[model samples]
Target: SLKGEARAGVQFVKAQMGAVSPATLLGLGVGAEGDMAERHAHHHHHHEDEDHDHDHDHDDFETFQVDLPALQDADLFLERVKQVIIDHDILRLKGFAQVGSKPMRLVIQAVGPRVDSYFDRPLADLEKGKTKLVVIGQAGLDERAIKAALQS
Candidate 1:
């Protein structure tokens, strides 16, 4: 289902880019790359099962809170997150983005680090797309800078 979703989403984006797709593209998986197609498919299915098994664990948000006092601006906060993404190649990011005048919080979840930044999906919330992210870093993040970034 993840692959299907990814494929459909890719089609949507491609369409936006003025490209059209035949029905055959629907059967192709989007997240899988070249080389280890068989092995990756097998592992990817198993990982999906594991994810379903642990879906409940993800609902708990104990680890989302950040206690750092140094992060004082929203822009700086986003910059730091950008830096983290640049530095770490394996880390996955999922959170919200807020732009000026946008009432909805843009829920953003990026898979992979920096070079492979892929936005996963958007949550259907009523609020102006004001998404929030719980960034994980070795050093504490600046909350104020992050908030300011949203305002700016």
Candidate 2:
């Protein structure tokens, strides 16, 4: 059920990427819940008025790496990636995509149970495209499901 929600959310994000606006600046920061708040405060440098304690719990993370096939559709692969991010307690993801004339670099960060929109940038400067990707999360990441999705 959670995976379904994540898939839906990612689909919305994908559509927004094209409909919203051209890619400009993209940044991703990750840590515990406490770390997230601290980082945000640090960047703003003016959240000193509110006294919040940074005693949040840290989550465990696992990692997965797979090379996509030559014919793998970038859009389809991304769809599956959303499933994995949702099904598993995935906290972070970084990868690349080369879809026809559209080339992009992706950085994904998930906080708690939330899968944030990945920042995408045009890779016009690169002479070649890369397909390999690494997914970081907890133990629930299913290698078989991911492989099956990519192969499908």
Summarize candidate 1's per-residue lDDT along 42-111 as a digit string, tens digits. Answer: 2234555644453343343222332222223445555555555544321445665544543434444554
lDDT of 2 by residue, 1-152 (tens): 54575533343333453664344223233235546544543334333546765432232346777666332355455666666656654666665555555455544344434444443776545523545567776555777776666456
TM-score of 2: 0.42
Worst 10 residues of 2 by lDDT: 22-31
For model 2, the stretches where C-alpha displacement exceeds 4 angstroms are 1-59, 70-73, 101-129
Report the Cα lDDT for candidate 2: 0.53
Task: Report the Cα RMSD per candidate.
Answer: 12.5, 11.1
Per-model tally of clashing residue pairs: 28, 1
**What's each prediction's TM-score?**
0.30, 0.42
Residue 15 error, candidate 2, Å:
28
